[model samples]
Target: AVRIVNKRGQFMQEAVPVGEGSMAAILGLDSDKIVEICRSVEAESGEAVQAVNFNCPGQVVIAGAVNPVNKAIEALKAAGAKRAVLLPVSAPFHSTLMQPAADRLAEVLAPIEIKDITIPVVANVTAQEVTSGEEIKKLLVKQAAMPVLWETSVRNMVAGGVDTFVEVGPGKVLTGFTKKIAKGMTALNVEDAESLEKTLAALGK
Candidate 1:
């Protein structure tokens, strides 16, 4: 995973110049309204701004060129968004602007040895479980430049009888999202040894 992500980071840098693109989180707005606002911003500015991340209900992230990103932020605020804030990041990820990066990543992945996994994995681009190696490979490439259907992915898992989610590694942002996305579902995070212990105890229950 590290090897794959390292190349992805390099290609992301090459895809867009530093400071040329930006990302913003739009809070307390429906996804449909956010999409409509992004369309208006793109038409007016003739730049690329898209609703990229559907993190949860009322929480969407947009990414594109700096000008349009900011324009969308203002418009979202005026459209009655609770908070539309610019994110501190170097690149506009998971937007059409990252197509170049996706293209590069495709080339890098074509020849690598990727075997099919037995366990199901929900793809970010399609919001569906993909088990075939080839299908997973294609989805991974598209994920770089496509909107992440995180909310849909989580709901799919809920429908599949997954009532508990254990997020390994750092951060509780996903744990928060799961709580909001699937109310009453158990969400646990393991960021350190102590957290891991707690997570295991919770799972044992």
Candidate 2:
């Protein structure tokens, strides 16, 4: 439940490089289909495009070079995709294009000591819980260019008896995705003072 915002770090700083990347959200398309779309676009355009985020069922985000991303959007739309919209982001995060950033991040993290976790931390790269500090450090580096297995992580949590999700961030994006991921689950968010009060009221706290 760690939120990294307005933070200065090698990973965050390197993930965003100027003018060489773009991202887009592809809705109403299965993960496999989106992967296919990305592959096709990359092959045709000779540029990189990869599925970066599995937000929920039928909702994935792709990232790569700007031209190829645009190409994929057009191709996806032509292939009967319900929506393919460009995201307002500076870099093609979680794609192979970010490998350089990941490499730099690994160096930066090498000296930082990671403490053993008391609770299970689900990794974005593996969609599984990791407890070893070393493993966590490695995964954090890899996650820069690796697809975020958010859907799998959520499903795993649900299967493990998690029925309610509270998003503590600046936006309700994750809350919306949670609802789409599990219809029977409860999703709530607290992004501001008002939202905090509302969440507290809902929780009867």
Candidate 3:
């Protein structure tokens, strides 16, 4: 089972839908472990399963693995899912499955005029902060087909003296990962008007 932490407390009482296709988190395993597991599962099941999202330490979210996924797929099946399939993404992503996508992204980015980074944006590919525009561009392209090092990003941010983390996305996914990475740090998520107000009040803004 995946240990999903709710950083903002918003997810503490939320109901998330089982998205299109199938998704499962390889629990008690790192990215490499998950990849190996996916390969084995795929070979036996003859399905197109691959590691997709990297949320936090020792957790790797995998999609595809449709056939064997039923045996090891988390929560969803118990929640009444019959089977999960590979997502409709261009490629499998992150598991050496998206080399083609990476190549394509490289081609697309080669001619684009990228602007310099004005702020310290963390590289999703490396989970390290980068301020150089050129490096950012390359990293961005790679990120499309690479695993997100969110665990590293949060750990590094805490180590680098970030006491507060504010997530501004459609889901509270990043904040949840941050909480798992840095338990001592203050983290918040702002996804709606109420959430925004709560965040401002929490920060005493």
Q: Model 1: how far is 204 from its true place, Å?
A: 1.3
Clashing pairs in 3: 49-64, 49-65
Compared with the true structure, the alpha-carbon lDDT of candidate 1 equals 0.93
For each candidate in the order shown, give its overall lDDT on alpha carbons. 0.93, 0.84, 0.63
Clashing pairs in 2: none
Predictions ranked by TM-score, top down? 1, 2, 3
Give the per-residue lDDT of model 2 (tens digit) for 138-175.
Answer: 99888888899988988888888888889998999889
TM-score of each: 0.97, 0.89, 0.66
Instruction: Report how far residue 45 has shifted in candidate 1, in Å.
Output: 1.7
TM-score computed on alpha carbons, candidate 3: 0.66
Model 1: what TM-score? 0.97
lDDT of 1 by residue, 125-200 (tens): 8889999999988998999999999999999999999999998878899889889999999999999999988988
* RMSD of candidate 3 to true structure, Å: 9.8
**Best candidate according to lDDT:** 1
Lowest lDDT block of 10, candidate 3: 1-10
